[model samples]
Target: MSRGTTAVIDFDNLRHNFNVLKQLAPSKLVLVVKADAYGHGLKQVVQALDNVDCFAVATIEEALTVRKYRPKTKILLLEGFLDKYELKIAFEQHFDSVIHQQEQIQMFEDFQTNQVMNVWLKYDSGMNRLGFSGDEYSRAIKTLENNNKVNELILMSHFASANQKHNKFNTQQVEKFIKFKTSHEISISNSSALLNHINIADEWCRVGLALFGVSPIEDKTAHDYKLKPVMTLKTNVIALKQIKAGETIGYGQAYTAKTNMQIAIIGIGYGDGYPWSLGNNATVKLNNQQARIVGRVSMDMMAIDISDIEIVDNITIGDSVLIWGINANGNLPLETVASNAKTIPYVLLCQITSRVHYQYVE
Candidate 1:
């Protein structure tokens, strides 16, 4: 009877999501398992999705973690090499790298390795974050093409606004990327583009959030794409109390009750990856009814207003409360919680801390 919360992981649902993405577009998928598989536990997720075309991670360390679980599977270092030493290790381990900067190209030029490495040439397109610019793109590509240490070249770009359907920037970026075609493999679509913009062509799709059963499109949901939620964050109501009108709740007296009401204190907080900003706006599920959190979210507990619900009597102390998950009888989706928190689902999912228990299901 630990008051600590638990994160239930459904491996079957994760596999189902992989298949769903593969069916959505007949292309190879590089499941982006960065941020410890979006905080779903990296080793467990990699063990589950080892059959994917490849895996994408943000660091050489993340790539190494995936390599431990998936020894022979192709692992891409999305951030590419950090130094000359890592470049040699990446090749020794057969890890693919993304070349996005001229400095990286210089690093590649400086290194002399007999092991030919696969490289994904990143084009800035319009994100202006990573990847090479106009003439630099040609120089980098030409340099890699001529370098004997480079084995294969793949063209890639990240969409700045693919989630917004009919975004002109999507077309502009795609058009820009198409100009760099060098008969190499191409990958551009993320979860949003794969679900919303299916017309875009690519040999590979780098999917991260969608594989975790979260939708990237603004107008649609995971249900719209036949994806299943893989992670369910659950906790229990430890106590309940009645409050009179004009009384305040939590620190700073943030919430003043307008009327006499009942509140339930759940054992979860920002320390457990629950956003403190979600105090007044977040919703949780109890007996299939939504309960709004009131006042500020403390480090160990938060108060929820259960006065408006019909089954308050039935929701006793020690009863289960769903922080976020998919349920047929009104489970609170992560998207809803994220929307209320004024953030994207990715941030919320990745923010899940290690303090929470992880229960993996086959």
Candidate 2:
């Protein structure tokens, strides 16, 4: 077991979480594999969730990537019909669309053929990043229906604060969606909505982080539910050194030991998608033993305090080290780790750059 890196993903756990989410909503479960299954590996994660009904993606290429695996899964394009090729692919590939921006309306009209194209009118339920509102939404629905092009219509909206169960905004958004989609079915639910906003699970629950077994709200761990973490982020230790007092480690000299201390350099770092904002004190579990980061995390390395581990020198240089996810205490759940870093789980998972290997475990 080398010291420098470890990322352990549990397919069984991921599947369990997905099942739990499906049981929560009395509607279709739309597994979201966007951002490469939140950096846990796209095809790898999809294979684990073969039982799911559909998937959602942000771009055309992302949808295509998933199509390579589960070719027949119903895919809904949240961003909806962009390029001319995207419009053509939507019909040919049978991918659905969540038409939000006005331009998307023209996208459907310009399409060579809308024979099998299914469209969802995305409404502004609160989170204003996308979707139409008020007269714009009403008109969009009418335009699509009037054109006699779209074969299917579903109402869609993103919740802004479903994580906050007490937030009145969730109720407001639900009301708005009901009024907007009165004549159509709908797809609503992000990770937060499934766990905390059960009251409005709606017809289609877009399971994302929830399926990976992570909580949507701050300070809320998935352990509170029956969910299990799907990814176990692990790394290996590459080197060990005992530095004298006043010695600094890694780049930027972020930590200067006050007394003689032992440090362990880990293989995985920010470049591998480990969050940098977690600071030097971030926790690590090596050989099921707890350790702490002591120096600034470099692009490819992390230093940890290992003076307390028994038989420290006997430990080989390539021992496994957990960067995030379930450890001795239980699932670290990437979404929770993201919150601690003051970011969203979607970004934390998607930021997992490229060229990473995924080892599947049932």
Candidate 3:
């Protein structure tokens, strides 16, 4: 049998999360489908959802990918175009663009297209990332407002600490964003901002991770917000053996057995996008019981300590193992895994490699 490392995508849960997010937000939704819908398969996700106000992506090619599935749905280029060639494609594809830099605005002033383009003017409130700041922000607004090619203009900014509900930076970002807000519609609430009830946007809220049924906030799980996980990563036991006390396990002999214990080799590892940083610290679900990882995660496999499991003796080759997400016994939140790995849910999802198989369920 083939190695059973797989990412099972539940479209029903995806739609459910979308509805939950839509009900929570005051304005329409700009579903962020960048990074292959957070590695849950972008094309399938775009086609599955209906009534999406807009689909936002990081790059021009990703925007085009969404466009291929959603012919008429609005697609926003989060980083906007890099050069005139991409700008031309944006216009041709009717993709909305985020104008955050002086050069992007200059491109608009120089391009000779009769086709009008919608633009999101991103202000660098505090993130100090891609955005216009201070006088540059006002100058860009004036330039875009005068440019004939520019159509609907929306004011936007990003929250640097929306995930931390008590972070004062969130308040500062809102205040900075509000100072420049005009009669135009605005988009400032990312998944964290919307979920945490921070400053909800007036016209649109760009949500990405939350829609995939994973929480963006620390100290919280998606279940805490009534969100169901859409991606359940699973693998299979390929071998089982008993290790004597003091015997080290796997590469570099990272882990030593304190007593005679059972171990199982699962067909998944960093090569399949499971974080290597999780080595010797993370756990996987086997027979509905948590099995501690025993060593450094290898390229195609890892060892799990199954000696303490109640059903340890029952586990056999080809038995299913849950890396994360819902299963028969219970759900393992990606948030929990993220915390253990010293990372975040977004990285875990997006880092999933193509080596793992994908199974979509309605």
> What TM-score goes with each of the models?
0.96, 0.93, 0.98
lDDT of 3 by residue, 163-234 (tens): 998899998888888888788899899899888999555689999999999999988999999999999999
Query: What CA RMSD would candidate 3 show?
Result: 1.0
Question: Best to worst by TM-score, what's the order?
Answer: 3, 1, 2
lDDT of 2 by residue, 1-362 (tens): 44334455788888788778877887888888887787788778776677668888888888888888888888888888777887888788889888888888887787666376778788887888899988898888888887767888888888888889888888888888887656577877777877884466477888788777777777877788788877777777788888999999877888889889888888877887778876575677766677878777777878898887777776667777766677663334565567667897667667765544455677
207: Cα error in model 3, Å: 0.5
Q: Tens digits of per-residue lDDT for model 1 on 78-109?
A: 98997988998898999999989888888988
Q: Lowest-lDDT window of 10 residues in candidate 3?
A: 194-203
In terms of lDDT, the poorest run of 10 residues in model 2 is 1-10
* Total clashing pairs in model 1: 0
Model 1 clash pairs are none
Q: Specify the highest-lDDT model's number.
A: 3
Candidate 2's C-alpha runs over 4 A off are 1-4, 327-336
Question: How high is the CA lDDT of each candidate model?
Answer: 0.88, 0.77, 0.92
Angstrom error of the Cα, residue 206, model 1: value is 0.7
